[model samples]
Target: MHTRNVVSGVLLGIGVATFVDETVFHQLLHWHHFYDRSTTAMGLVSDGILHAASMVATVAALFLYADLRRRRAFAPRLWWGGLLAGAGGFQLYDGTVQHKVFRLHQIRYDVHLAPYDWAWNVVAVLLLAAGIVLLVRGRR
Candidate 1:
């Protein structure tokens, strides 16, 4: 039940995923920018925007989680399910829509993308499946 808890977890999950993407691929690995069809300055700006948004989401989610805990209405199972689902959903969308459909950016550039694409999507699906299973179990 506890819809608020689930929402909080989902937001946190999205924030975490975005943070990881920005830090690992964009920063550490020097992968493509959020918008690759632009100058380096523009790409950096886009990354900054994405980072800000993710931070906002993380802070908001944490505040909501704190409130739920204070109220003693936190639902652990549902929250976990929501977290996994949110992360998986975001990843899947990024892998498919952002990469393929919109051509915003790819997992990696100047490389054969089939394996990376498959791995990314497969992981997303697994996460989503685990979340669904948890949600169903939590319902009972």
Candidate 2:
């Protein structure tokens, strides 16, 4: 149960999730931006900022992971659990706080949002649940 390993994994997970959101939804699909209440240029800037932050998190996580590995203190199960939890937590926050509360952005526009919202939150819950299970099991 190395705390550093879990922290590293969590950071990596957040980075991966943000990367996917930025690349797939924001770029490939032309979906909403991080801040939609602005012009296209502003949106692009916001996306760039998000991308940079995610990259920083990823690099930091990798460094931590490498250190854990070098010390032979890597806890695979705990790390994986943290990874899933972090990903799910981020998605859940985005889906709820960002999408609904702050109105930062929606999953998609000009569509029935109910289904997408439900699916997004549901998946987040599942991921979080699985992570919790793994973490509990790993403790034994």
Residue pairs in candidate 1 whose N, alpha carbon or C atoms collide under 3 angstroms: none
lDDT of each: 0.88, 0.89
Best-fitting candidate, scored by lDDT: 2
Question: TM-score for each prediction?
Answer: 0.96, 0.97
At residue 115, candidate 2 shows an lDDT of: 98
- The TM-score, computed over Cα atoms with residue i paired to residue i, of candidate 2 is 0.97
- Find the 10 residues in a row with the least total lDDT in model 1: 1-10
What does candidate 1 score in Cα RMSD to the true structure? 1.0
For model 1, how does the per-residue alpha-carbon lDDT over 15-127 read when each residue is reduced to its tens digit? 98889989999999998788888899999999999999989989988999999999999889888888888888888989999999999999998899999999999998888
